[model samples]
Target: MPEAYATSAVASGATGFAPTGGVQPILSVKHIEKIYGTKDSVTHALAGVSFDVAPGEFVGIMGPSGSGKTTLLNCVATIDTVTSGHILIGGRDITNLRTRELARFRRDELGFIFQDSNLLDTLNGFENISLALSIKGAPANQIAAKVHAIAETLGVSDVLKKYPYQMSGGQKQRIAAARAMAAEPKLVLADEPTGALDSRSATVMLEAMEMMNVQFGATIMMVTHDSYAASFAKRILFIKDGTVFNEIRKGDTSRKDFFSRIMEVVSFLGGDASDAR
Candidate 1:
């Protein structure tokens, strides 16, 4: 709708575009392709998918089952490899990195939150969050303040002393989010972050994610099937048949308006209500 990189590069039918708006994109997916199997069993999990996420932006990826949303996430997360094209994070071409370099790159530049909390039962909230900062080689003395600061922002400060089992579902997820952002990684990959929560808990989790993006300047890329969850993002990229189908922004619009547009796109994509919710 606007500039190709800042506003609607997807509308221009472009790929691998670097933003010209002073600030460079934090994550660039350059016509990445992921093909599974071979010969007669070939499955193109991703076909020339490309997008740029600017710094401090919250982006959502939505697609129906078998539409390659998860596959795209995995490829960006470096949990899976792409068959073609390149991926760059903070301008580093991760696709060309060696195995050891890839490990270090993932550790230093990436953060992840899954559908489940995935926190260790043995670790308290403070410890869990601290572990991430520690892995990034944060000074031991600064770790506590970082953990507390992020926890406070995400509304998980009250549970920092408690174990995962001792907190509510929403609290645990918030803590997981805090852990992901504790290192202040260049990009955070969230996969179905609110999937395990009930309606109320999901609302709280989404609010926490919003706070993480707005208050702490975290760059987040979330993959969610729920339109309600997708609405929380600053922009939504709809994928169909392994390609970006459409893109919309929440620019100068209320969340309700954004959600309405997302629903319309979902309907047009023939998304299953049971799965998208």
Candidate 2:
């Protein structure tokens, strides 16, 4: 097993964060490995994967289906363990936390968005958002204020009374995002957040996510296979065979140009066989 990345803890405002100075990463993965099966037959789910996401930065992870993108996300999110190496969040080693400690850490420090809306059908949009607070044992009066504030920021306040089934896919997703942010987590992890939306809806959701990252100083790491979606990120990491193969920053390029660059990289990874067809 490889050694974990060492970090320095520091306090910031009321957050008790130990941000890496300058380009210090809020989330760091160092030479991590995940292998399944016995010594005789092993499946390497991850190999030497390492990266860092700084506070308030937006990063995207891109790869083919089996390239370990989701695996890497899971490992960093502390939902899965690595066979070797380490994952640090806010300068704390989560890989060593016990199961219950990990649960509390995740609930308090991470927000998640998935391809599915994942909102409860029985709950109104506002109730759905408030439910997270309720589970966290927040006061009743505070839940209302918090839900309204976050919904307004997410542009979904008007539909708070509506059910998920009554809302458009975009609206449902917006609600999901609002719910995620209401908890005020240190890091937001999204897996193909726009995968189920139409192009227009996807655009709206992506814009909302970008807004959160910029306005709230929310750090985000999104895993996706779409160039269009990844282009919305300030930085992109391309993974291949469980390792980072390339990285690109937006720089001064337009979104379309950045998308093109992403596609070129994807094509290269595909051995010249890419494009949607």
Q: Backbone collision count in every prediction?
A: 0, 1
Residue-by-residue lDDT tens digits, candidate 1, 13-56:
45553333668889989898899897989888888988899999
Q: Model 2 over residues 4-62: C-alpha lDDT tens digits?
A: 11122111101122223567678888789899899899888887777778889889988
Model 2 TM-score on a 0 to 1 scale? 0.88
lDDT of 2: 0.82
Q: Model 2, 186: alpha-carbon shift in Å? A: 0.6
Worst 10 residues of 2 by lDDT: 4-13
Candidate 1 segments whose C-alpha is farther than 4 A from its true place: 1-22, 273-277
Per-residue error (Å), model 2, residue 248: 0.6
Residue 6: error of model 2 in Å? 30
TM agreement with the true structure for every prediction: 0.92, 0.88
